[model samples]
Target: MLKPIKRAVHFDFHTMPGVDDFGENFDASLFARQMKDAHVEYINFFGRCNIGWSYYPTKVGYPYPGLNGKNILGDVVRECHKLGIQVTGYLNAGVHHEALLRHPEWSKVNMKGETVDLDPQKPFNGNFFRMPCYNTGYADHLLAEIRELLDLDVDGIFCDCMLLRPCLCPNCTKEMLARGMDLSDEKQVTDFAEEQRRKMIRRIRETVPEDKYLFINSLPCPLTKDVATHAELECLPTADGYDRFVSQVALARPLYDTVVYMNGRFQCCWADFGGYKGKAAIENDFYDAIMNGASTCLGDHLHPNGMPEADIYRDLKEIYAKIEAYEPWTDGTRFQPEIAVLSTVPKLNQSHYGVGRILGELNYAFDILMPDGDFSKYPVLILPDEITVSGELREKLNIYLKQGGKILSTGTSGLMPDGSGFALPQWDFAYKGKDPMQIAYYKPTFEEKDLIHLPWECYEPGILLDASEEDTVFARHITTYFNPGYDGTHFNFYMPPKGETGHVAAVMNRGKNVIQVSFPLFKAYMKTFTKAHRILMKHLLAELIPQKQILTEDLPITARATLTKGEDYTLLHVKATYPEIRGTMGVIEEHNVLPAGRTVAVKGEFSSACLLPDGTPLVIADCAGYTKITLPEITGYAMICLK
Candidate 1:
């Protein structure tokens, strides 16, 4: 029932083969051959969406002139159809095509009203735009071109780059005026793209019929992460932008949670613009992306007559095998709205933005989302710090709250973007320590202690308030600040934005039973409190998922449980940084397969997939959210049992 996109082959035109076009590295024959060789189920490729010129021979737009080649796209379509493969057309949503440069008026402009081409000579920079998504005449023109392209009888038309934000154009200004949002300030431009994004999705959906595939290469929205009638592709950058963007999409980006609100079948694509150069990197990326609930799509710059070298093809085949072997399954329940954050992006201080800590550590557990929207899908939206939010998302958040949702806004939240009246939360107290406290607490300890002082956040120290004001309260604690006197929003933990003092640590909502916390719940409160943070996280989890009585203690650090019908299995993977292990900073992740001390518990007999934890009796984990069994510190292994 989930029409998810699992595998896709991407093709880029090297150059137009016609006499009018200068480059001619690609042709129809080469593409068909490569796609067939790869054994791809789907195909995504970029075609020129220029004002008048066309990649294929079109009546309205001339093909690179003076050429008499069979329409390359036409041939590819024929070959692909013959081979039972699907073809989708790619377009630019933010910037104009090469021909649009001739009319500066149609170019993308920044806040200053100066129009500039993303590429004066070419349209595709692969990095998307520095501007926002909405407010461009190019979208209109792109629509015109798409209407023509759809006539080719392709299976679907993929509208790429439509969700790219941050463009300042004349039309954008006019559109903003129409929205009653007149602004001259420069910073307001950061989120101007999201509005247009909604427009772009709407236009594409309307233009395309109900049954036609209308793919919007979008991050998040009121949009569904899973359900796209038209397949979507993310043409992410290879190096810096790849993981961040892919994680955003796979984990359900923009503003929505993975759990409570995900729209089903939103196919995820991991872009590798470099093609063959960074194949291992590509493989690793796809693995992580899929693990986080997404499919894969690789990006390559188009050139005529050129294929992504032999190595690229070979690497693709290798990864293909890996993906196929996994036999991944998602049973409908995975599609729900859940909010996620990078715990990383913004640098509150000027120096930290580029040099901030990497988000790769928790990539498996959560999503690294963009700053344009408010995630309503999640029952609790946890902010590590203040982040860039758009006004559009603010409205969405208002809707979510009005419908009875809760948010755990922590650190220097509400300090970043989105001109909403929302204020950043403040912790009344600070907890002091000599060294950065190791975040450690087991499931057993959590079940016993039942509290956690989460770390990796900005905090302020003081007395607390028990009075339930307009909003109900859950939990709060005091902290002692060591490196005191650091002013101007200083966060004690590793952060892009530093909090000064009196930051919001953790709290829950009494009304909707919504709860939010800062960072990984074990850093501050429970870790240092009378109880451990693991205990606190269990409490939060219990509060969030009251329906499912998940046992907090006796579970692995990287434990994941999948329950279906009357059977269930808990996948337990040791964290790379688990086991405070006294002097050991963090464990090497690869050690999971080596078989450390592990105890197995389940509802049914242990299957052949597992080994006894040092010969402990394997039983069914029939505890709370099921059962909790003692297990080795593993990051990617599982405990299988039946309910």
Candidate 2:
């Protein structure tokens, strides 16, 4: 098995030209010492930046003019090697400003037959302004740079910005035409672009040694898992918050042997030199990664002077000290999820984010899975929002269902690829077309009325379905009096619920193992955190899964709980820190503590129960095939072990 990256730092150095005094104040020994103090075991130093300038003296690429004759990359590599810290050479593969300026023919042309370049008005706004076409001579230039980094004796290569940007360059156009592909078709162009990227990855994988690590950023997991050594999820919470990170981690954990969660140290995002996320937020990010079965990597931009930031390392030292203490329990543990959510695509969508957030907030242990992922292990599988059941996947799911697997499918999940009808016979519903009323309301049945009393408004539309006579209806669809829209007369601002349409919104089969909801509840819940949606989901889960992994009482909705199993024990991780929305940014300034007297019940019996790291014993009892324990006051994070 490959060794997981526990503590690492990604040092970004995308410096522009005309910068003077580069590497003038660099002390190789001091830099290594600072990393050692911060407990960093691995580092990704800049080899070739987005500006197409190498930090080391190179023959294949232009050296940074500010470097003047200093081989900063080599010096840092030697120093970090002496301290047993592994180093990977970083290279910006897609965007090369200097190369594009020197060779205009290598630039990527878009569908409009126009050369893709940075906005002339805001050229310096982002680093990915001008991208080079891989089908051109730029591919050879990129490969030559990788060889140079290998010759420099770096431990590995970290290639960045390797996304699929469809190009219409002469070479790409010729190749597509030769393959009889229609350039006008968007899907064809996208597939061709993905093939080009896969070719580049294969070439890079061949260049790097099998033993050495090679990570390609922005490559979708399980699709490109064969070309890379491991997976790295780069998520800056300030920009998109923790939902994306959590969803990506859940998708990658089951596929890769080693997965690293990379988050920035900057308060806003990358390249914010004056910004810092402070100790509490950093702790929250790191612990969240660890509990989700991924190692942590902090993102920081190195100063042009080549010296480490003193204040950032100081804060890192304090935060990493706690991580080091908790490593014993988290080192080789595997996430124990009771439910598997089938992901519609390699890249996560709104449905993925919504389902992940709802499951996480509800303290239900679940993992995001691909269509081909194993389904037999999980007691219940969720097809969220937009998953179309393919023929091969339909066969696999049929076997799983025959073996007593429960499924909760929503919206267009169980539908056939052609939208004819549901592929699964267990659904027990006939698919009519989409509802004409885009927005409607949901009314629960009399039996489940206590869960949600009144009609809840659904902003998204649902598929029209007619349930079989044997099916049990949990909720009914209630159309709106009229969709809020301008009718060329007076505009309708208010929409009230009309009478029930006698059509089922949520239904279950006679076996009670398969439940299907007509609407896209997960996406709606993610867009609008409606309490009734979550309540309805919880009610559905009660019927699907009678015994949950972790049951909590008196716990705040903000708190998150995950279960993991180690060699000798089962660990229940609980995190209680909530991010405060401050002017468009979610900030965590302080850790909130939950008072004692909260109770938790873990499924299965254990010999003993105690708190992690400290080994403090907790009172435990057996209740209905579950081991119940009373949790002490927990601040920030807590791990309970049952062995």
Candidate 3:
């Protein structure tokens, strides 16, 4: 098997044809030395960029006009090899501008009979805007380029922009017709495109040796797990933010043995020259990767002059050096989650993002699971908004519930395939279609009313549920006076609550293990970021699984905590640096040093507790069923190990 990537760099070199000084100051030895200095174990260099310009002299493709005769790809591979660093040649598989321009017939034609492009208005704005059909001769040309990269003795091939996009090109249409698939049906066209993409991936995987790495980017991780050697989560925090990365890591960890979290050094996003993120922000990304049992791959764009920004390497050296120190503890550790959230879809969606963010903020260790995931492993399973329980999945859930597994479902989750009622008999409530009111209010029971503001406005519509006599109503729904709309002469800016409707908003069955919330709380929380929504979720989760794995005292809501288990020890990671929203981006420039009064109570019987790497012993005390440890003053991030 190929070795796992610990610390890697994704060097993007997508230069347009008009660049005059492309690779003019190219120094392969200097580039390798810089990467080695930053403690990079693997480097993904460019073999063929999206602009359809090969970095080196190629027999099958167009070389960069400014390269003249210099074989930059070959030189970098040979130099990086001398430093014991692995390398992967990157090829833009989907969007090849030069190739599409050369052979316009290879371009994918959409249903509108227009070529598939990112922006229909600006057809020639960017190199990546135009997409080429994979079923055409372009596939053969791409494979020939891959063969050239393999002959260069690189470690592997990394194919970018490998997405399944529906096409109506002549080649695709002919293939669909031959297969007796209806070209008019959108689903059939999409399925055919998926098959074509997969066929190409299979060919590439077959060509690559078993010992070499192969990564197909832009596809769902589970769909490509068998063909792709490892999972690369390409999430740039500045553009995509932290929630997407967190959710993707949770989804990818269980499928692949080696998962690499790819973030960029750019302040904004990819290909931003002279843009740099703060040291603390980059450190947080790397720490998040290791804490979640994944490797790190920092992204950087090579300047058109073929020189790397010296400051990027300087920051990486400090951050990666810290990661290297903690590798012994994090190398093979697995996440120890106390809860599993049954995802509404196979891919990452708003529900997953909301649940993951809320759970992380609440200091709860959880995993995002598919419908077929092992629900018995977690103490509680969450069916987020709109999880359709098929017969097979319902059987699995029933078995899990019988084995004392708790379930917290919201919105339309747990509904029957026909949407008649709840699939699980334990949920003693009748689903009475969706409420007509677009904006409703939630009122907690008297006992829990002080938790948050009563009559909390729900921005989105929710399902109406009638709880059975055996069910305990925890919260009631309050109807609005009227939805915010113009009624001829009168217009309302916001909907005002019109007294309680006596309908159940949140309820628990007699078993006390199954709790159901009528509203689409996950989606509402994601879209509105309402504190009440998260508060209600936290309260319900506590009621479901009262004995949590990790409990914190005096920890701020902005801080995040996670638990991972090694062979001989359990690791607790705490991060306190919160990103501040500036303009359109979340920027993290400063680290918050928490005071020393904070304490963490872990539900385990470990004999000793100590800080990681430095081996600083902490004060540990044993409670009835938990171990309480007084943490040291933490700045940005800290890890504790219990044995």
Candidate 4:
């Protein structure tokens, strides 16, 4: 059932006593009505919050000081369950204000012997949450709270901020010393802390029944593979940009049966009481999540009166009604991914996000696959910048190449595990060290017309390459003599190019279906958005995987297009929303309109093509063995279902 969560909302009731309440004006019927109006099947209500106070009548942990014997949590759970909506209990595990106040020693101790919390010297300067070290006796107290909350009959438990940062508390230091480990070593301390975090999750799992799901917030780092029951990515696109919604979802969806995109309704993050995102912004986020095969969970904060904010729920109801109508097309659908970006060394530098972004912008269906994943299913494999390959992985790639698997390796990606030299010899390209220029440029050898001198904006260098006769060079790196600087004589307007075009920028080993770029193409694009970056990537991708399932005309970079296959039809989700950086906050205050002249080309046979929700047939024309379908004027988001 894909973890039994489809449309949901996360109530981040992390409130303080003076500013928070306990169902003072909360009406059960009104609460159930709001949930039903929103069409949410699951909800993450608060049993506890970061301030270390319980909502339900609790005996293990401290209840809200001002609650006055109100079982608000139990009351909400009963109401939501009665309305046929599942509830996941929330526990603010990392920052327990009450625990820190009761046992000061349990607070996380930095190397400087300072507890990690809001700095007294600066107001709102440091992190507001006071993290408690899980390695200490605080773990036992947290577990006791979890067990106490389990008796409330929740469908699941979500432990928030469960990560264990580098701790130097007395308990942690003593354990490290006993293990014969150096306390000064950051890696050892961090790894030990991570193990302790996992141990706590295991303890929670053992305490809970098998049917109840236990999820740790931000658990992608330690429990990436098999530890978590489901996948949930905390993608606050407004804070991190809308591109992150696709990047994070693509990375997590392939690994888990169900993926949930947790985004806040605030302009940036959680705990903004009056901050409300525009209707277009919320709709775009929800559409993007479902298009990428993820369930949607909009995060919101309750008011001090324990009442569901009427304005937020009013907008949510309409947004989720649209989602409810589109769920039939999204559910049980398989996303056809033709490209895989390998995120081998996630700890070092992984360009999955950059690669995924570029691929999506170009209307390519792709997935971010780990190094150990089976790459044979994908026609093209992208080894993004700085992905060092182990001996075992190198062998696997070598064999996969012989089986006609295509590879697009970027700068230093095919390097040996120790970062010495190239592990795959089929490319027949030798790295001639990093380019000495501050900002290099790409010169396409074969182009329709003369191109602008696209400056490699960032200070990152490109590796000079020497290709053998077996490889064909499509582009060359243009190096500059030196960076122009302000001097006494005159400030140079521009730097002069070296005019030496011997270094190879991009090469294609057609015999083995391998394409290698000497520069860190994906990383460069991530750092700076330049036409040159997209131009070169597009050229290389076209040469490697020319045939595409879908193509679009006049598609904006702000708009993302995804194609998924249902049992009897194909679903196309076109989402576009312009989010301007308004006064240091990234928000979509206005909805951008999509012109009517835009068209989508599908490379498949369909009996009929029509716009979704209304079932209006579109004129599908045959163009070069592809079906071209014209799109209507879209205001924010549109879904096209082809049968």
**C-alpha positional error of residue 361 in candidate 1 after TM-score superposition, expressed in Å:** 7.7
Clashes of each: 117, 0, 0, 0
Worst 10 residues of 3 by lDDT: 120-129
Comparison by lDDT, 3 against 4, better one? 3
Q: Candidate 2 lDDT, tens digit per residue, 131-152? A: 8888889989999999999888
Model 1 Cα lDDT, one tens digit per residue, 1-643:
2144555765544333343543345556666777666655567655553223466666644455533544656666777788777777765454444545455566556555544435555444443333333445556666776776777666667655454435567667766668766557555654566566666667777776665555665444225443455223343333233223333443343333222111111112223234243444454445434434446666555443344555566667766665554433332213122334434342122111111112222111333444444455555444443443445555555566566555444333433353232332322222221123222112121223533434323222222223234433334333333443446777455323222233233455445443433333322332233234334444554555444312323444433332222114333322221221224222122223324455433333334333213333433444433344554444333322222
Scanning candidate 4 in windows of ten residues, the lowest lDDT window is 448-457
> In candidate 4, residue 134 scores what lDDT?
82
Q: Is 2 or 3 the stronger prediction by TM-score?
A: 2
lDDT of each: 0.43, 0.85, 0.85, 0.76
Give lDDT for model 2: 0.85
Better structure of 1 and 3 per TM-score = 3
Off by over 4 Å in 1: 1-3, 12-30, 49-53, 62-70, 117-140, 163-201, 218-283, 325-643
- Alpha-carbon shift of residue 496 in model 2 (angstroms): 0.3
RMSD of 1: 9.8
Kindly report which residue stretches of model 3 are placed more than 4 angstroms away from their true locations once superposed.
Answer: 116-125, 178-185, 446-450
Task: Estimate the TM-score of every prediction.
Answer: 0.60, 0.97, 0.96, 0.93
Measured by TM-score, how close is model 2 to the native structure? 0.97
Query: Global lDDT for candidate 1?
Result: 0.43
